[model samples]
Target: MADYDLEALSLGELKKMQKDVAKAIATFEDRQKAEARAKVEAFARDLGYSLPELFGTETKSTRAPAAAKYRHPENPSLTWSGRGRKPQWFVEALAAGKTASDLAIS
Candidate 1:
């Protein structure tokens, strides 16, 4: 009823297939993580810890602000406040013709 020819796929079709395969792999990884979480929950029950006591979010530490300042390595003159997109100094340096290798993590 359905025609299935593996050899008839174009490059775009092949790329879509690769994307689908990657998504499937990611889904499998998520399922494995869920299974591991279930095992941990069971172990916590055996240890007499309440589910909330064992896995509650009541003890989370605050994350540091994203806008903390740092310097670029290759160009020590460039500084960045790690906020939204790429830093302005980095962009300006790139606009002035600098490669990614020209920047270092400071």
Candidate 2:
């Protein structure tokens, strides 16, 4: 790894580097999980069995993504799953006195 001259770098450059580092850290976990899963699958295959066969098909790792539960009133393309922090539009809708039911997908 190259040594960074943090004091000599501009604010924008430092911010960009911070963002890049954050992204790399996030992806590293995913890469590790994928590598471990691959190794386990390979081991299972050597024993004439698949990972799914040993761990069932409905494992949390293979679960489907949450379906969107609400959409923007003006833009149908923008949606929310009603999970985690609400989207900007969803928050604005609530501030404007629109209930969750008002924005719900029908």
Candidate 3:
């Protein structure tokens, strides 16, 4: 709430102020999140359900494992889920005049 002449502050003073501001912001955000979580948990309890029961536990894996979509022709064991970056072998195969469809597991 206090007004600050930030432009007039020295470099060292500004850096210190920046650090203090960052810490304050982090603390404020944490406090706000905790308060919100408490309110949600209380409402869930009132509805005859625990917080985790209402909103599934964070420890549980939310996504199913990705299935293998592509496989190396020379070696059936070499497989790719086709999610992220293409593997080096896949790139080499493509460079050797092989179409992407040629690597399809199905």
lDDT of 2 by residue, 38-71 (tens): 9999999999999879988854566688999999
- Per-model clash counts, in order, read 0, 0, 0
On TM-score, the candidate that comes out on top is 3
Q: Which candidate is the best by lDDT?
A: 2
TM-score for all predictions?
0.44, 0.55, 0.55
Query: lDDT (0-100) at residue 61 of candidate 3?
Result: 68
- Tens-digit lDDT track of model 1 for 1-106: 5575758999889889889989999999999999998898899889988667966766679887665365665666666665668887777778988765655453
Give the true-structure RMSD of model 2: 10.0
In angstroms, give how far residue 51 of model 2 lies from its true place: 1.1
RMSD of each: 11.3, 10.0, 4.3
Q: Candidate 1: give the clashing pairs.
A: none
User: What tens-digit string does per-residue lDDT give for candidate 3 at 11-98?
Assistant: 9999999999899999999999999999998998899999778778869667998999999999999999999999999999999999
lDDT, residue 64, model 1: 75
Query: By TM-score, is 1 or 3 better?
Result: 3
lDDT of each: 0.75, 0.94, 0.93
